[model samples]
Every structure is written in C-alpha cells, then in structure tokens.
Target chain A: MASAPAGTLYRGGEGMWSWVAHRITGVAVFFFLLVHVMDTALVRVSPAAYDAVIATYKTPIVNLMEVGLVGAVLYHALNGIRIVLVDFWEPGPRHQKAMLRGILVVWLLLMIPGAYFMMIHTIEYLFGSTS
Target chain B: MSLEIADPRSPGAVPSGRARNRGNFEKYSWIFMRVSGLVLVFLVLGHLLIMNVLDGGVQRINFGFVAGRWSSPFWQTWDLLQLWLAMLHGANGMRTVINDYAEKPSTNFRLRMLLYVVTVFIIALGTLVIFTFDPNLA
Candidate 1:
C-alpha cells in the first residue's frame, strides 16, 4: 500500500482531531478514575488521613488545575452525546455539519454558567467573605 | 471497508453513484470529537497538576481539605463539570468505535442500548455522590 501525499484528505467523513481527542480523554479519565477511587477509599483509613488528603486541595495552583479538569470533562461529555446520536441513528449525511455546530453552541452555553459558579465559590473560599 | 478507485476514462467507468446524503448526526459527531479533544487536553493536564503538584503535593490531601473545598459552591460545580464531561466524552468516543466496527444491526442496537444505560447510570450516580457528600460522616 503506497502512502498518500502529505495533505491529501482521507475519504471517510471522520475528522482526525476528534478521534485523537476522544482516545486521549478516555485514557486520562480512566487513569484518574483509578486514582480517585483509591483516594476516596482512604476515608476508610482514618479521619486524620482523610483530612490530610483533603488539605492538599487548598493551594491556588491546585484550584487552577481543577479548571482544566472541568473543561476536559465538559468537552468530552458534550461530544460523547453527539457521537451517540450519530452511531445509533441512520440520518442522512448532509445534516452532519449542522449537528456539529449545534453541539459546539450547546457546549459553550453550558460551560459559561458552570465555570462562573466555580470561580465565585473559589474566590469566596480563598479570601474571607467581604460581604 | 475497502476504498475503490474510480476510473474516469473507461467507457463504463462514468460514476454511477448518487451524491452522498449528508447526515446531520454524523456532521455533529465529527465536530464533537475536535471540540472535545481540544478541551480535554487542558482539563486532564490541569487535573494532573493540582493532584500531583502544587502546595504540599498529594500527601497533604484529606477529608477536611475536601470539606473545605466543597463547602464552597465553586469546587462543587468544578467537580460536577469534570464528572459529566469526561463520562460523556468517553462514551461518545466509544460509540464511534462501535459504529465503525459493529456489523450486525441487532448487535449494534444491543451494544448501544447497553452503553446508554451504563453511561446514564454512572453519570447520575456520580452527580449524586458529589452533591450529597458528607464531610462529617465518620
């Protein structure tokens, strides 16, 4: 099988970025899930141990990291819903572009409010309430 | 799924196929993968940094730490987003792989239905856990 030229478009409708993202997110989530479960199970270890674990979350940088986790999970969830519809339903291919746009708009809308709440709470927690 | 090369010069080789029908669903799925992938990069990376690095590292984490964080609405929402997004993104990706590979319609249907059930169940259960978490419970 001869390799195609560098810029040639593949025949299938599937986009490369999406496929890569899906796989990457899946692996990341799976890894985190293992760690999360193990950490949560620490509750059974002792109150002192559990408290020690929770304290690490207070660092400002850690809060920043939470922002990324939220973003990853949001993108993955929204796109996953889109994939589900495509696979199970045999709709005409023409509508693919429209559906993609719709997914993007929906994701943006949801994330805005979700992120806003996260920020407000973070600020309140870090700096003693002014109001 | 083998790709066939169409010959333009052959007498009988004039394309016989009709214009491909553009399905709305597929377009959306394609778009979704790109958008989701871009976002996942940031989220996953951020999560790793916070959990493994920054301020006393992983050793300082504890129940009071979680309680303190969640006591604020901010962390709760952050966590909520993470749970929902990751699960949905992963399930969607799996759906794509299934569609591309699954041959039998019945098998596809059964597998998808099962996937839906499990995905919904986990999402719901996770949401509940996040909201109802008790910091004081011994």
Candidate 2:
C-alpha cells in the first residue's frame, strides 16, 4: 500500500480512531495523575498549606477540567476493555468495529450520568454565589 | 511462533518470534495491558467517586480530609498501587503507539527516550512522596 504524502489526512476508520483516542486519553490521564500526586502530597506538609492548594480545585475552571478528566478516564476504561478483548478473545479481531461501537455506547451510558452529576454541582458553585 | 524476527514495521502484524523468549516481552506487555487495565477500572473509578462525587465533591476535600484517609496503610497502598499501575500502563501503551505511528526510526527512538525519562521521573518522585510522607510535617 502506498503511504500518503506529507500534509494529508490519514482518514483512518474506527480502528485507527480507537488507537488514536486511546493514546490521547492515556496521555491526558497520565498528566493528570502527575499533578494529582503532587497535590495530594501536600498533605504531608501542613494542614493550612494543603488546604490552600486543594481549595483551588473548587474554582469553575478547575471544576470544568475535572469533568474532562472524568470523561477521558471513562472512555479509556471502556475502550481499554475492548482492547483486552481483542487481545485475548478469539473473536475479537473479527468484530473489532462492532466492539468499538459497543465501547462508545457504554461510554455514553456511563459518562452521561457522571457528567450530569459533576456539572450539576459545578454549575451551582459557579453561579450559586451570584444568585 | 516462528524462529525469525518479524519486521516490526508492519502494522496490524504481531511480531513472530523463533526463540522461547524472543517475543515474550511483547506478549507480556499485552498481558500487562489487560491485567492492569482491569485493576485500574476499580481503583480509578473508586478514586473518582471519592474525590469528585462523594461528600460534597471536590469542595469537601482538603488537608484534613486527605490526612484522615492516608492515616491508614490501606489508603496508602491504594494510592501507591494506583500510581505504579497507571504510570506503567500508560508508558507501555505509549511505547506501542510510538512504534506504530512514528515512521522514522530516529523519531521513534527519541520519542520513546523522552517518554521513558518522564515516566521514570514521575514514578520515582511519586513513590518517594508516598513512602516518606509525614503527616506531622505541618
């Protein structure tokens, strides 16, 4: 197969997108984990110091980022299960596209509620003070 | 497994190995992805729930909240395992991704070098922070 020339889209299907999304989500989660560790480590320093750092999480921007984090983690987890199936199950490769669709469906089901709850509070926090 | 080194450039091709351990690293890597992924489901979900959803959400969490939790060895272990598994799983997954996408060998080598350095640095720092943590440091 001839490879595409420079400055062109790969135009890959679900398989390609799956891998791409997995890589992105994995990277995002890893970065978040890095920050999370550092922040949580604050507890070892002092109560006032730790509270000062964590208190910043309540702001609207960080709250919004938390929602993104939740979405990424859920997508990664669901798609990760799909990847595991493809690796170990005999029928995995055969139904790879179908599994990808299934992963999306599951991700939506789980993420909708998670996002709703997350936003409900964040939104309140965002506007509740003004109202 | 054939006794020849399958060219690694072929997409969708699993590297076939001739020797007993020739491709076992890849095999184990695959297995690790599945195993750690499964465990991460629980650890990560539980973590998100406790951190983001439970008891007034993120607003409720603070120094006393964390110190209270980590006072027990159980929470410490929970965090430690999560740190290790997530870092390893992500690094290994990225290794495969770079192998697949980076057409140039040099690009692959350099990208992986960066990934490894960051992974090791984060893991080491995280581990030290976890183990040497003193609740009384305040």
Candidate 3:
C-alpha cells in the first residue's frame, strides 16, 4: 500500500506527539540524574559540605522543581509502559491512541496527589507552620 | 571466451559466516531499555515516595539520614543497583537521541563519545560513593 500523505495519522498525530514527549522527558530526566548523582556524591567530601549542598534542595524553589521532576518521571514511566505494550501486545497498535488518552488521565490523577504531597512541607514552611 | 558461472554454494562465493553472526548489540540494547524501564518504574517511584513525600521529605534528608539508610545492606544494595541501572538506562536513551538528531556522522561519534565518558564517570563515582560511605564521618 502507498504511504498516506504527510499530514495523516501516523505522521503528525498522537503517535508523533507521544514520541516527542517521551524524548523530551527522557532527555530532561537523564540530565537531572547526572546532577543528582554528583550532588549525592558530595557525601564523600564532608557531612557539612554535603548537608550544605542538600540544603538547596529543601528551599521552596527547588521543592517546586521536585514536583516538576516527579511529573516528568511519572509521565516517562507511564508512557514507557505504553511503549512496551505497543511492542509486545498483539492488539496494542489498534488501541494505542486510546492508550495515550488513558495514560494522560492516569498521569494527571497521580500528579495531583503527588504534587500536593511533595509540596505540603514547603507550603507549611512558607506559611510559618514551622521554624 | 566462454563465460563461466560461479556456483552460489561454493565456499569462496558465499559471504563470510561472521557477517551473519555479528553481535546482537542493537537488539539487546532495545530489550534492555524496555526491561530496565519497567524495573525503574518501581524503584524510582518508590524512591521518590520515600525521599520526597513520606515523612518530612527533603527537609529531613541530610548526611546523617543518608548514613542511617546506607547502614543497611538492603538499602545499600537498593541504591547501588539504582545508580547503575538508571545511569546505563539514561546513557542508552541519550545515545538514541544523539543518533536521531546529530546531522553528521562525525558529530554523532563525538557526542556519543562524550556521552560515554560522562556516563561511565558518573556511574563509577556514584558506585564508589554508595560503597565507601562512612556513617561516622562528622
């Protein structure tokens, strides 16, 4: 069969977008892991030095960033599962579009509680709940 | 001159066997990404819960807290496996990205070389840190 013209389903639709999103999130998470390992490695320097560096992570700004990180990781993980199903399941291709919608719904559902739990400490601190 | 036809089944006429039996690196790399990704979904999400959402989150995590956790063989093993798996997984993912986007063959080789260097360095550093962490270091 001849290929569909450029703007068809496989070319510029859900499949493409999911592919783009996966690559973007994967790259972001990969770079973050590099920095995270380096930061964790600070323990070998000195406890004080390590604690001093980790202190930055506790700040409200970075706390919010952690929520974003969680979002990226969660999306990547869920989408990754979708990819696996597409590769290994017989009916996966037929249902991939529907699966993307399902993945997004699940991602949002998890992110709401995830972001809240991750940020609750920062929220409390900002409001003077703790010293 | 009469033309002679070579037999396809002759040893010299056939291609080398090694060509057909070359390694399955790409196939294994593809399989590795999927397998490791599935494992990481559990390991990383669990890690996030414990480190970022459970008690006080990052506020309570310091050197001592790290020491306390690494004191256990279980946690040490958990972290060591996590470091290696996540780093290798990320490296492979980045290599794919570079392969897809780099316009020139030379650029691809250079970028992947850089990626390998950093990936190996980070993995080695993380492994050493996890292995050599001293609880009593004040």
Candidate 4:
C-alpha cells in the first residue's frame, strides 16, 4: 500500500506550476491594467476627482492588498524569467529545476528589501512621521 | 494475411511525431496551469479587494493619494512586486500558447523574440516608473 501509486495524486515536473502561473498572472494583469488605465484616465476629468479616487488606497486594508500585489508581481517576474530560459535555450530537465530554485532565492532576496522599503514608506505617509 | 502495424496518421489516427511531443509538452503545461492558477487566485483577489473595496474605496485615489501611498516604502514595494510578477506570469503563459500553436520555426522565433522584447521593455519601464515617480510634478 505504501508503494502503490495513488490514482488521484500525480507528481508532475517543475515547469507545470510556472506555466499555470503564467496564464493566471496574464489574465490578472490584463484586468488590473484595464482598471488602472481607466482610473488614470480619470485624471483628465479633474484633479480633485482623481485625488479622491487615489486617496482610497490609504486605508489599512488597501495597504495589505498592495502587499499581495507585490508578491504576485515578484513570483510572476521570477518565474517568467525561468520560462523564457526554458523556451529559448531548452535547458535540460535537471537544470530547469535548479533554475527554478535559483529564481525563488532571487525572489526572496529582492522581496525582503522591496517589502521593507514599502512598509517604511507607508508608515511615514500615513502617520505623518519621517521615521 | 496482413501483419502491418497501424499507421498513426490514418484517418482518426494521431500524427505520431507531432502527437508525441505535444503530449509531452502538454503534460507539463497542465501541471503549470494548476499551480499558477492557485497562486494567481490569491494574488488577484487580494489586489482587487485592496484597490476597490478598502478605505474610502476607489473614490479616494488621486496623484496626491498615490504620492501619499508611495511615501511609505510599503506601497512602493507592493506596486513593484505586483508589476514584476504579473508581467512575467503573463509573458510566460503567452510563450506556451505561442509554442503550442505557432507552426513555422521562423514564425515561432519571431513571435517569441517579440514577446521577450516587449516583456523586457514593460518591466524596465514599470520599474523605472515606480522608483522614479515624481508626486510633486506640477
């Protein structure tokens, strides 16, 4: 029983997640882009109106959401780089896994600094403190 | 009286060479779709809730609002991460679509090359914008 392969549990190779992430991110980014464009276009209507819309982002909940957005972008960027490598260069399967791991490490390193800065900036802006 | 192996290319039969590679690539692609899809669900929903539902809602957004937000290192980082992840993910997905559908080698090469170029351009432009955004530019 221990050795038996479960029909429901299939172990796929490394590239699978990357591919799925690609599509999901693509759709998401497209939606966000549409909204962003529309919102920015609102600037043409009136600065006051635009400022009203922008001010909504200052809420705590929205700040939290921005964190998630950061994560998505980081993951997508790192994985996209991996996919590009695999597609154009055709790296070996073993190398591909290594590459994926490498991507994750890089993401971690970059994300830490990115998050720190963003946090500091947010805190300063909301609290009216330079610290 | 015939012992001929069935040619996979016959009517209703799979094209052996093409079918084999397609099957292999697709197996990997299916796995990717599942994993990325799950992550994306979280990333996207979180984004929507924050931008549209939180605080005073969409009405509060503006240049000064953005400046206020970015003044915090938090939003800057958040926007940065969002930019990189979404762009890369979208590009990779498109790469798969191109590989699966594009027939000619040259066509595939050109299309992919263009994709890479565009992806890089956007990423660079976005990063620059985030880091260099001037909120006081009147």
Question: TM-score: which candidate is best?
Answer: 3
lDDT per residue as tens, model 2, B31-63 = 898999999999998999888876677878876
| TM-score leaderboard ranking | 3, 2, 1, 4
How close to the true structure is residue B106 of candidate 1, measured as C-alpha lDDT? Answer: 86
Ranking by lDDT: 3, 2, 4, 1
Model 4 accuracy (lDDT, Cα): 0.63
**CA shift of A95, model 1, Å:** 28
How far off is residue A40 in model 2, in Å? 2.4
Give lDDT tens digits, candidate 3, residues B106-127.
8988999999999999999999
Error of 3 at A16 (Å): 0.8
RMSD of 2: 5.9
Writing each residue's lDDT as its tens digit, candidate 4 over A1-131 gives: 34544342223445566656756756565545545544554444555666666655555566656665666666765676565556556553446778888978887886676555445546556776564
Candidate 2 regions exceeding 4 Å error are A1-11, A129-131, B1-23, B101-107
lDDT per residue (tens digit) for residues A52-86 in model 2: 88878887788888989998998899888888788
Best by lDDT: 3
Q: Output the number of the DockQ-best candidate.
A: 3
Q: Tens digit of lDDT per residue, candidate 3, span A8-123?
A: 54566788889999999999999999999999999999999999999999999999999999899999999999999999999988888999999999999988888888888888
